[model samples]
Target: MTSVSIAERLGQEKFLAQTYNRDFLHVPGAFADPGGLVSFNVLSDLIARHRLEPPRLRLTVDGETLPQHRYAVPVITRRNTRWDRVHPDELHQRLAKGASLVIDQIDHLHEPVGDLAASLEGWLRAGVQVNAYASWTSTEGFGVHWDDHDVIVVQIEGAKRWRIFGPTRSLPLHRDVVEPEPPPAEPVAELVLTAGDVLYLPRGWWHAVTADQGVHSLHLTCGISPPHTGARLVGWLADELLASDIFRTDLPIHAGPEAQAAFLSALRKEVIGALDDSGLLERYAAARDAECVGRLRPSLPYVQGVPADPELMVRLTTGRARLDIVMAEGETVTRLTGAGQQVDAAPAAGPILHRLLNVGWHRLGDLADTAGVSVADTAALVAELVGAQIATVRSEGR
Candidate 1:
């Protein structure tokens, strides 16, 4: 949306030490024309036209969901359904009378927002999910709450006031041990975000938002992906260690104390052994990155292999898919990256993969000499990735 990079908005690694998770940040006029952030009319139209389902489409008020039938077609609310229990019609009436309307994960349905999210992933080096929240009047949505993850707020249109209380808890998780204490009565800082204004609030900070600016409000909250934690690593380690014979052995549920102690010692030794590996966590993160599947959209019409057209654009769907790299016999080696899997090519493949990875798209002829392959052959290789949905092919003029 704006030429301003995410690094510029949130600052980079050097700034991370000083600014991250410490205080509230507000950047005004981040976009040249702030009103162009998103289309409020289009969003409202989508809500009326589409049959938004639960988990995807939800209306929350005071931290509870409203029934679906009232918002959708005029029909009976299914008794056991999640929406029926929440009673959305009543919630809408309450919102019209000043209630907060929150729709989680709105990027799934919206296209403009999705494009922004993809761009952000390229900049942030991690996955990003955008949620939409709309409100009328001055009523607060969730009434003084803190999110478990950091958020980048883009005010699409209208205006909203934010009261930030900061966080009492540190790096809290969704399944946290204890809930954070109520925010202080007086806010540590107050901010009013106009269209195109951007705000960054780290996770665990207490904040409240309302469309109290005398006009309807619409905004998107882009949630940042959290760094890998020890909990995740241990969980992955447990799975990896299942190959060991001791780990495969059954628990000594009814065994004698001596037998149980021996069993416990064996398990601990195996767990500790895995932890001792200096590269274990790095390997785990690489594995996780390779497996991550970002939003995969279909490429219609040319369902078959991609044509060897130089103008056809391509990009990877997943942000974390690593390029392949491998060492070989004697002095020869291979380094492959991008387009899902990497292949050990002759020395020529290095420049080709390097070029493609460095830039979003390149002409087939451009990579032909570098990869030691013809333009058609390169197209076939790209087609393989397109078929895998890891890469996409878009015609230039269409």
Candidate 2:
């Protein structure tokens, strides 16, 4: 089966260089089959099976979040533990009253959405979290609110109308000292998105959504983490500057004005020098990608070690993993860095790791053939990756 690449769906380099983090993009029928990734049936199944509580699963109307008691009740389980499960009758009533349903971090619970988010992370070089929204009425769920992080919204089931008021503040932060002023009275643009439509809204763009176009709406909003800021760069630079004695020395708190001025000048020069490097942003982005704490999954049954089974399937868990080749003592060494862990292996294993990083899944035999090694040796290498929580193995295809 052919796989749908999210990067291609979003227009790849064109979207990244032009529309990403700069302006809103509306792509009609971009998903073609959004239901393949998620659907109303999937949301129903999740609600019926999982013990989801407020915030993780919420009902909101007119910008106010409804309490859990409005739709769910606590029931004593057979284990004598109290669990809050969705009361279908109450949930229906609540929806009838114009409350929108929300499932936070749906990517973690759904495989297709998880893969979509991982693909986005690989393309955008930033972490992503996908939230599912289902609305039945024209009532707005969030009113005119702006997210701190940029969002790529995929309309999965129905139609939703969005009134977008462009940002009044420049790159607002969650913990900013000043709050963004109220949005303008009139929206800059209004868009109606139906099934298979995709929308990208940058952070700080105030928008209100409603499912009033004679149809209910179900959509997945993929929240991309905000880009690195100047503040963050300065913090990282401070740590990087510790190598200099001037930065390590104590502050001239009780010294004369001349001493304080000299100290300030020296500090400014150090910071400016670091900022002058043309590769500063590139280096910072690499560090962030290398340290991404990606989703973790356990390779069950093979608790101790992976066996040399030809049918076993393996894949990397982290999408933002980095592979580097280094020549040490006239011999090539390959380094795999990601998910807060680093692994070094012989150059022969580079092909195998690169394949796992890019491909969704590979059979042990295929990986062994790619690396030109025995199945047993390949299994051992995969076991090391599994131990580091960077990769997982399963008997069934994912």
Candidate 3:
């Protein structure tokens, strides 16, 4: 709801070290203009323009979903493709009667939410998905539940009550061997989130929410995936170890004890040597960052290449892009790695890469000026990145 960026709202240093993943924190009045972030009017636009259904656009009451027919009509196009076209009257009827509305992965559908998600992704160095929730009554939507990922809730308008019961298990994964115990009958904490408030709840925390303040409510939850764990490290090791013969060789399924023992011994040695490096974690993170499938968008109108148009805007679509310096033929070159591609550039382009890493769009002329590079060369670099899908270019409309 705030004009200030998500990173500013959440002081990155203090929150990450002292609280992130370990606890919950709530900041009141974090934003002043809640409507600017995401408002009732914006929700109306998204609902009217997009053909949403099921989990993407759902209506619920007391945690149970309303049937699709209750709020939308299935439309079959001439091509035989079908979609649920939302009927405004029926949808309003459901909302008026206490059903909560939810738009999942709204970041993809809405730009404001997308920017918020992107900023969080950049600062947290992890993926983020945002859902928009709106309610008109005290009816609960999902009941008391726990999410597999951490969330930052922004109350865009009105107020909502949250009952926190805490986590029954620590760091529960979506696909885990064991399920968490049921939350306690009584909540450990009860609070109301009003307009402009922000709340950070770690994954595995049990909580229930409702719009019980006699006013309609609209809020956004930016869900962030849990941090890389030891399990993730081992999983990554599996892929990295594929280059070694010990890992590539077939298992001794029918062989003698000595054969299996030797295979196991060699495997252990390889694994130990791989894990012995202190920089393994950093390398693993960098690999993941490079592969990040950022907000994939095609640069239309310029499919062939980007022209040297000074007013055009450009931005890196991925939040986890990594910029590194490498020695190339006795000279240092900058490597911009992201979205599954590595692009090596001249040293002067370092300034341009650094500028693009920041949140939001940058003008083509401005980026060129940042590095003192010619517009033609800058456009060439931008075209290469846009081709890779790690970054995007747009006209001055933004």
Candidate 4:
């Protein structure tokens, strides 16, 4: 998080607003130290330490997945067709040679990466997930293909040549009825991305990448701003109108066409009425933000409740945690956004949440001072969060 505004980092909002569905964008040299943001050594260490399985951790060439045994042998092959042992050295050598490596859901494996994704989601006002990709040679792993969602690409090391052909479909999705038409034979643009370059490619944009610059390349693709679909709208509506008898009734599958048509007509009215509200989108956005289950991590020591310790440092464990104010019984309630958790403190939790939401880091004493509460009380509150896995406390190495 540099202090750069979303609009500034994204260039002109109007430009994106206009061309968002029509074309692709390439912002070269966007970051000063892209490679430094995440370390390849750390990622390699994690993959080996965790023994992560794929398609989560797979090497691909031309849209085909290389056999796991090519690198990793099964120390224990299971009845479920899964293996426990994977060859890290062989996998590393393949990546260093030019094969594409995809580590899906990178956030789950790394804390810094997860935090960065959450921060972007907050800034962009949408959900974001980061996937890490690495390549060593001049082979196209996925070939010329389009993603179902928009991606923010950060080139971490070496150099990668990107041939951008732009988008053929308008706002495509993973579960859409129609796919985009084939991309043009010729690329619309060609660009070389080196360390620290950031690229934005809209969904349905056909592009190809290769490490032709003769160096190994590692990058993180932060997928952002997934669009809400009709299916989602209906799902949300069903949850909201669960109390309605007609909605809760079983479908008239056994009825005649006329009877079914009548049933559908009524359902349509209710669905349309729900969507017609001006606040529908905003409400959906909020609900989605609040319900997001971030990377769950447990905090040691504070197993029961937070101690009244003044020197403890606390930070949110989840990147997308929400803090809001609501009036209940003529008093304001401090509502924690994600996971629908809330606390009814003596107007003191408000300051704690304010500091939690806006600041990246907080010490127990500072939060207590802001809330006009004792350090011990603040520690107790933090302990509760730790128990819920929503916040973590760092111990000063004594």
Candidate 5:
């Protein structure tokens, strides 16, 4: 990866104001040396190291996922557990014949790729999962399709052509009420993404891709979690209404129309009153953000507590982790919420939390020095977080 952070290189402010959730964006030469971010070697190592299933790794040809049996053979472990082990020779034959190789959740498999994903999550304040795609032939890996979530693409090597037809339906969902109509005869925009290029496409945009540049292609698709919507708000509201007796009451099954109308009338009133609250969306977003669990990882070898070593590195497990101010005992308190835990710390710890909320690792000593805290306090705080799996720590050498 370049010394430059991915968020800055993405021009976060400009993209949000002009392009986010509205249109597509293409930036050529985004990274002068994208190979450092991820290469073919990394993918090879990951496959060899992990017992990846079809969901984690698979091959596709023209939108259909090829059977694992085609590229792997079932192996019975000593415990008698069976799983298809990918055969390098068969896998190569399939890819050479025009099938596209894909590794889902590549971010979880590789640390650098995980860092790349965390940068986007920190900027967007949304979950991001990156999948790697590699193709050797001019085949349409997924045919023509649209995604339920927005995606940012990084062309790591070679090139791939994309035919963008825009959206036929507005913000389609994975379990949508209606599917999009057939795309038009021609694409609205057609372009090739070479190494170091970046592209962003909003959800529901129709597109087709092919690696027909007479060279193999390797790319990463970073899909952002879908934005909170009115539908989701209503779902949340349903749970919130449980405190009220009317919502908790049984539905008037087999009741007369007049009685049913009375129940609905009360329900409608409750719904309207909740919707009238102007901060409903804001409140819902905060709740969801607090509940988000990002990249849960263990801080091994420190099972008991984080040691008071100044050189130990630390980072939040989730990029979406957030810090906010709340009054406690008539004094200002810093409340952190992420990885499914809420921690209220002294206001003095705000700086330390802020540093950890960023996208990379940090030394415990550096966090203490920068936050104006003692190494002992820093170790204590990190120990608490590490115990909760809200953050992880490692030695600098590791």
Candidate 6:
């Protein structure tokens, strides 16, 4: 396997800690060879192979989404399944007439994009989703709009102009009590992004984009899901306080004023005690990571058990998996948790498990050698991980 890491290629740490979610960051020529990650050919192959239907693949022009029937036709498959098939000729006609294309959740269909999303999730400690947008005209696909989550955009091909109007509201939620006011008459900043350039925009930053730069445009936008808010934290605290009888008791809604006051006081005390811990947020994050539902993949040929083949490749499916060393009884144990499952193994297997997490793909023999164990033992450990839905195995050619 190639040892080149994406972190070094993207200068991920420098940009993430310094600017992520704080302000807009524009990096010129950050991805000098963006084609290596994705290209027009890749997008075409995905559309053709996946039988992508309307909405999942759609078109927009002048801030209005075009109807699905304009570019695709519904068909019934031999397997009795119904799906919409894109009419290539009609699709091209629409694009030529100034319509932009959009594909949602492209990361799930593309390997390189999936890896990119996983890398971001590992770095940001949050869920990430990638969407693709392509345009042929200067016409705006979506008008001045704001996203509920922060986005990292990469210009894969051509150039596009952006007009950014600073946020009118602070940290707005998708379901909020109040809506933000209209943007001001003038934009705060204007930028034109070309091939290999990168831009990061925080949530609620109103921005409008158009490909009026005399060239077509293709780009990928990776959306980073927000972390837990104070409201969510309090909800989790309520669950944690279930051990107290006061929390379980009926509300004193019909009782006297003194009785209701006592109930409120007791509830406040339990909440305060839970919030007093210095590590409350840390604990909540760890718990969320442990229970995260990662991408699901099947180890087809090895449905029963992983064979003791040295050439087999193995990798973890979840980006948020947690690995830790803990004392169990008198012996040290290695615990791996993710994808809603947990597994414990001997301390000696730590090296093998850690490699699976950090490395994209490793041969069974290489992992066995690193762990100083037999190939059969390594296969057994990997089988346990596969059973837990946190890891997958494939033949060498795949």
For residues 270-353, write the lDDT of model 6, one tens digit per residue. Answer: 888889999999888887787766677899999989999999999888788889998878878999988889889998899999
Write candidate 3's Cα lDDT for 1-398 as tens digits.
32235557777788788888898888888877777777888889988888787889999987799999998898999999988899999989999989999999988887767777877787787888889999998888888999999999999889999999999999898889899999999998888999888999999999999996768999999888756778988998898899998899999999999999999999999999998999998898888788787787777788999999999989988877889999978889999998898888999999999999876789999999999989999999999999888889889874
What are the C-alpha RMSDs, in order, of all predicted structures? Answer: 4.9, 2.0, 1.9, 3.4, 2.1, 2.3
Give the runs in model 5 whose Cα sits over 4 Å from its true position. Answer: 1-10, 252-263
| Backbone steric clashes in candidate 4, count | 6
Error of 6 at 67 (Å): 1.2
Instruction: Give candidate 4 regions above 4 Å deviation.
Output: 1-7, 12-22, 76-89, 250-266
Off by over 4 Å in 1: 2-4, 18-23, 34-37, 48-50, 75-103, 110-112, 122-126, 225-227, 253-259, 328-374
Estimate every model's Cα lDDT from 0 to 1: 0.70, 0.87, 0.87, 0.75, 0.88, 0.84
The residue pairs found clashing in candidate 6 are none
lDDT of 1 by residue, 1-398 (tens): 53135457666664467776666688887765644545766666666666556756666666666666545544345574332234446656756866556666666566556666666655555567888887777777677899887788988778999999988887777877898887789989999998878898888899988885657788889897764567878888889998999988999999999999999999999888898999997788676665656667666667977888766766666655555556677556544433344445556455665655532445667766666777777777667667776666677668
Q: What's the lDDT for residue 59 in model 5?
A: 97
Off by over 4 Å in 6: 1-18
Clashing pairs in 5: none
- lDDT for position 157 in model 5: 96
Give the Å error, residue 145, model 4: 0.9
| lDDT for 168 (candidate 4) | 78
